[model samples]
Target: MIPLSPEILAALALALLAGLVAGAWPARRRLLAQAAEAARQAERAAQLQDRVAQLERDLSAQADALESWRARAQDGRLELAQLQAAHHEKLAAFEELRQAFDQSRATLRAEFQHLAGQVLEEKSQGFSRSSQDALGSLLRPFREQIESFQRRVNEIHDASVSGQARLDTEIRRVLETGLKMSDEAQSLAMALKGDKKATGNWGEVLLERSLQLAGLIAGDHYQAQASFRDEAGNRRQPDFIVRLPDGKHLIIDSKVSLVDYDRAVSAATPEAREAALVAHVRAVRQHIDDLARKDYSSLTGMKSPGFVLMYLPIEPAYIEAMRRDRELFDHGYRHNVVLVSHTTLMPVLRTVATLWMLARSNEQARALGDQAGGLYRQVEMVAARLQKLGHALGAAAAHYNGTVTAVAGQRGLYGKVGRFAELSAKAGRPLPALEPLLADFEVQRLDGIAPGADHVPETGRADAGSPPGAVPEDLHPPGEPNP
Candidate 1:
């Protein structure tokens, strides 16, 4: 409120200006900082907007890719379904084929069993009746073997029949196990490829199996490894000795070498096969020569034919030998040796058995003829005795009629006996009443043979109570009518 001079006011203004300037400087610094902060916020907001736009574009692209994946999945499902249906069709077709195969197999098996059973039954029935006598002992060893063979054959046939379900399962399993069998076969072939002893043993086993299949009973119909001594005192044994129906023997040799033949089969090249086949043929010829040199036919108890059977257990080996050398079989034949395979020897063994059966049948027939002759002689003696009995009976009937006529004829002992009955009553003791015999009553002759004149009247009369021409019931012989 006090009035001041101008000079004092001017000095105060200068000081106040200085103070305002200091305060304004701080405010300006604050405004400049606020403006810089606002510019940074706007730039950050622009960057955020650009980021949102990029994210939306990315989201849209992902949604389109997702739709494409959904469509591709739908097409894949359709394709998979089609493939599955095709697989099912093929499976159904295969199943039908397998079922048909099983049905056919079953039908064939049933038919085979029926036919074989009929043949076996007929043969067994014939053999049974024929074996009841002396032949029984001869065939005893064979019966059990034949029955066992038949049972094994039946079991094999039964085992061969497989159901459809089993067939399916086996089909699936065979895929896994089939290669294993092939591997085993290869291993076996390798084992026997170069080994001579093992091959020979296998051949011998095959020969024995063939013998069994041919229904030859060992030790009965055939002897295995029967020993014989030559004139030089050397013991020789044949693989098998078949007993012929004529009491002779058949020698079979199973020691044929097949090493070269196995090599021929496994040969890779045609030239190698040719070389191996030539060696096989040479080996076969050598074996034939060896058999012929042994001369089993001349052995003491062999009784074999001029020819000895050289058994080649493998059919292919025999065929290969013959094919390579056309004259191989002829060569063997010339040397008194015959080359035979399993197929050929089976028929020979069967023929020997047939011959034995026929020989036994002839013996049984001869015995039957002798029995028939004896039966006829016995019948003749019985007829003579029956004739003599008839004659004696006729004579007895005549004697009986004569005694009856003497005792009970008119004015005979019966009338006298009737008078004695009254005397017996007067004596207080009744006599036994004697019945009278009729004059027409007579005994009939046996078999309608005419009786003696004293027994029967010249004119024929009916026998006591019998009709004319009727014989007594007890007098008729079996199966014969009365005359």
Candidate 2:
């Protein structure tokens, strides 16, 4: 309850002052530190705001660039689609062209073959007619000679029939003339018999006449006096070497021995005639043996058959030889010698001529086939060129379509340009209009290409009236007369 001492009061005032001073200093320091922290925080907030603004601008620029890229991508897609469509169209056109070319080649080949066959047939017919005319001319003289001989015989017979004395003298004169003619004939026969060259020539003339009637030519179907060398280097000449279409040669030899035949006919007695006939048979057998020994089949450069032909010039002589010795024919066959007369030889020669004609026809056909092969090769070359052209066209179309698709697709060049303009406008900076891209192109289709329109004429169609697979009548040769 007592009043405070003066020293205590003074001490308390000082302590109070000290405490107030100390408290003020701490508050002021705390307030200054808070102020400094607030200043640093405000500076950091300002920097963060600036950084956020920069990020916003960068994000906006990135968005614009992305839009532009997207537009370019759309353009690429559009170009690709267009290219695909163009490629498809080009491929279709190429296929059509190839088909047309093939059809045209085939049609041309058929026409060529048909024309060739017609031409060959015409030539064959003309040749045949000419040959027949020549053969007829050759036989006319022989026919006239026979008619004259018959008329002479009839006149002689008429003279003999008259019974008056004057007519008897006329008959005797006719008889003497007949005897002179007979003697002349005997002399000619004897000359032919004596001269080997004349005998061979006579036989050859007969053979030639027979062959002509048989439609065979000397050099074309048969060679006269054709010489060949044997394996032993011995050269021999055959009277006639008949050529076969199958590359075979028929050797023919004509040797007529009329001496024995004339002796037999003019023999004084039956025993002499028999001996003469026997001698004639022996001569014929010897000739056959000689022909066999020639071995014509072994001749070089000649495809001679195993048998040789023993041609008898006269039909009467052939008959007499056969009748006198029946075994002569068999012996000739055994010796590989076939005895043939003018009548028999005609048939053989005609066969050979027919074979030659057939061979000629075959050769013509082979030539035609070769021509066709050449034509086919040419067609193939043309086709290859067409194929290459088509391939190039198809590739071009594909590239063009791709370009169109790229230009028209979303995010393509046009799209990117539009987007950029829009972005510029939004930013209050409009861009100028870009140049317009090319409009989509429409490919035109190929037309007017058809098969066989280039080489073959349109009028070359087969006859409507003709039956299926019917050949033209001109393809066949004219009918020839039978030998």
Candidate 3:
């Protein structure tokens, strides 16, 4: 135990030594690691403090800038709000003023139109009165002369009526005397026995006088042809054959259709009148058929040959008979046969004259159109010059408009301010606020200040003098207090 073997003694010493070294090594390593950790903590603390100080400075500067910006933003917001409110207020007032102006303008236009109508009415009445009075004065002598002629005509008509009655009575008496003696001569007039030359000649005299009054040569323009050849070369004598403008022949057979008139005069009772009317209708039908058989259109190869004017030198009573029979009249018209009585002959002649005039006028108008066309072409150069003049005038107007607008702008500014001063002077005191009650000192809304405004003049003309209401003082009302 005291002295061990060499290996045992060395092992024990080495063991002791190893034990001490191991314990000391662990203690030194622990101390060294603690010191390193402490140094790392100190370096970290320094870096963190520097970072915190930088962060504080940055936050302070940021806070100051944010406050400054907020103040400026608030100020800008206030100003923008004020401008918006003012714009809205101005727009509202302008709309109100515009509506008032439109109403006033409409009222003025209506009043002016009413006054113009009254003036025109009064003027028309005066003109009518003057015309009537002048016509009365001028026609006084003519009216008296007309009355005198009418009286003479009435007296003549009465005398003729009396004489005709006496003649009728004498003729009846003579017929009665003859019927009592010669049975063949019963109720037969001497004229009906072909003993009167005056009856046939009287018709020719009437024809000559009527034609003369109507401006026609009896034989040259129209005449009664006793003998005429038909299309088949058959010799036939019509009452009258008229030569057309183209030398074509037309037949004019004179016949009186007096069915209605005879019925009207001869009927003694209502039943008899009715019976006679029926007979007259049958007779008229027969007459229309007979007239239609006379193919007047075939009388000549004229284009409008079917149209024939059937002449009837008869009284109005006979004409009225045909007129009363609508079927007969329509039948005749449809057959292209225009029945012309003595009363209607003049109108027929006038129609023919108008037709001739129309043809002549048409030819004249065509000639005039071509002649005038050439004259219009000759002035084409002058027309182009006039068009150029019109263009130049438009350009000049544009330039003048620009100048007037510029002048009006400048003048309006100065005039409005000057007028404001003058109005206060005229009132002898400072002006009150421009409120709804005030009638003077119109605002921009009433004046229509905007460009392209409906109330503004399109292009103002130059004027040496000022326009109406240019001076506000002139339009200012007298206040309650004397000025």
lDDT of all predictions: 0.58, 0.56, 0.44
Candidate 2: misplaced stretches above 4 Å? 1-196, 228-235, 262-278, 417-483
**10 residues in a row with least lDDT, candidate 1:** 438-447
Ranking by TM-score: 1, 2, 3
lDDT of 3 by residue, 16-78 (tens): 999999889988999999999999999999989977976796577557545643554465345
Better of 1 and 2 by TM-score: 1
Candidate 1 vs candidate 2, lDDT winner: 1
Candidate 1: stretches off by over 4 Å: 1-190, 360-392, 408-483
lDDT string, candidate 1, 1-483, tens digits: 889999999999999999999989999999999999999999999989977976796577557545643554465345435534644553454344334333433443353354334433532244444434543343343344334433533442343233223433432342343234334433454468677777667666766766665556788788887888999998888888888878888888888877777787688865686788799899999999888888889998668777899987665566557667889999999999999875456556645654664465445334333432332233223233333534454465567667666677676677677677666656465444444323221122212322332343222232355422233222233344332
Error of 1 at 261 (Å): 1.0
Indicate the TM-score of model 2.
0.46
Local lDDT at 151 for model 3: 50
Q: Look at candidate 3 and give me any clashing residue pairs.
A: none
Report the Cα lDDT for residue 95, model 3.
41
- The backbone clash count of each candidate, in order, is 0, 21, 0
